[model samples]
Target: MFRILNNSDTFITIGREYVLEKYDKKREEWLHIPLKANIGFQADGMIIDSGSETSFFASFDTFNYNFPKGDYRIIKVLSSEGDGILLYDDFKIDK
Candidate 1:
């Protein structure tokens, strides 16, 4: 899947692309979706991806979170920089 989306700004004209790789040691193929843009908020580290899933934003060095005492699971996802990122979900933030 090689889809291109133009993300141009007043000083630049950039775009995003998605690449797929196959015949590796893993499954049939892999999806590489790169969201190249200069808009909104940016995570210093990395994050997961979804076809149309909503992702939250938070800075551990700035925000305070009261995580419940419960079991959780971590899932890995691909980022725009072609890197694997593990994100923790099912958690709540304090008001």
Candidate 2:
């Protein structure tokens, strides 16, 4: 799950992408899931309005088939125009 808060008074159009990561025992490293999907607001490719916060829910099934239950991190890539920002770095999912 993710939340976007628009503090500005005007509407904000943003593009978003999500990346999932988990530890790989064999390689002793954290591996990123290959699923590159968009995080939409209200509707697919929709814009968020002023003083509104929106939450996006992502299911494990959306990333892969039969995803293992463990500690995982969700990376949110948010962009407006050509500038991109990475957020929710400390957020983790333990299932």
Candidate 3:
């Protein structure tokens, strides 16, 4: 689960486009991981007024795969009047 806070002065439009990536120490890059197959339906985008916030739930089937314990991040794209901004949040999983 995650929350998106629209602090800008104008309304922001957020889409369902998101990616899950894992950091590879050797390659020094974030590799994309396919995990959306486990999630259910999603809407195209949502408009949030200024000073408003919205939350989204990301459900994954953790039991099906053995994920490595390391740093991961969720990248999201937000736009306002066709201008887009990339946002991300990093997290760690310890088994």
Candidate 4:
């Protein structure tokens, strides 16, 4: 599971085992995000970027979920014809 610990970068915390990642993009040090053996799904080419402010999972065929029932606002994005992005205000990053 992944959660947002800040307003800018989304922290990717591993589940419950010995998973490790590079602390720095250009370093040899490794940091661990716990491992959940039975994640039930696979990310063939998972891309988790800290520069993004929101979480997204795409390319999945279908999802078994009910739509959100709450007050929400229209979100707008500007991008090329092939990409989609999100926009929000009151930006802050906190853990």
TM-score of each: 0.20, 0.58, 0.83, 0.18
Ranking by TM-score: 3, 2, 1, 4
Candidate 4: deviation at residue 20, Å?
7.5
Per-residue alpha-carbon lDDT of model 2 for 1-95, expressed as tens digits? 67889786666555445667876667877777764265333434557788887787766655643457655667776555546657654434455
Q: Which TM-score value belongs to model 1?
A: 0.20
Worst 10 residues of 4 by lDDT: 13-22
- Please rank every candidate by lDDT, starting with the best: 3, 2, 4, 1
What residue pairs are clashing in model 1?
none
Tens digit of per-residue lDDT, candidate 3, span 1-95: 89999998999998776777889999999988775356544778899899999998755452234568999888888998779899899999897
The true-versus-predicted C-alpha distance at residue 52 of model 4, in Å, is: 18
TM-score of 3: 0.83
- C-alpha displacement of 31 in model 2, angstroms? 1.5
Per-residue lDDT tens digits of candidate 4, residues 1-95? 22222233443322111122223335544333333454443423223344543344321123232223222122223222335444322211132
lDDT of each: 0.29, 0.63, 0.81, 0.30
Error of 3 at 74 (Å): 0.2
RMSD of model 1 against the true structure: 16.5
Model 2 error, position 3 (Å): 2.1
Query: Of 2 and 3, which scores higher on lDDT?
Result: 3
On lDDT, the candidate that comes out on top is 3
Task: Please give the TM-score that candidate 2 achieves against the real structure.
Answer: 0.58
Which 10 residues in a row give candidate 2 its minimum summed lDDT? 35-44
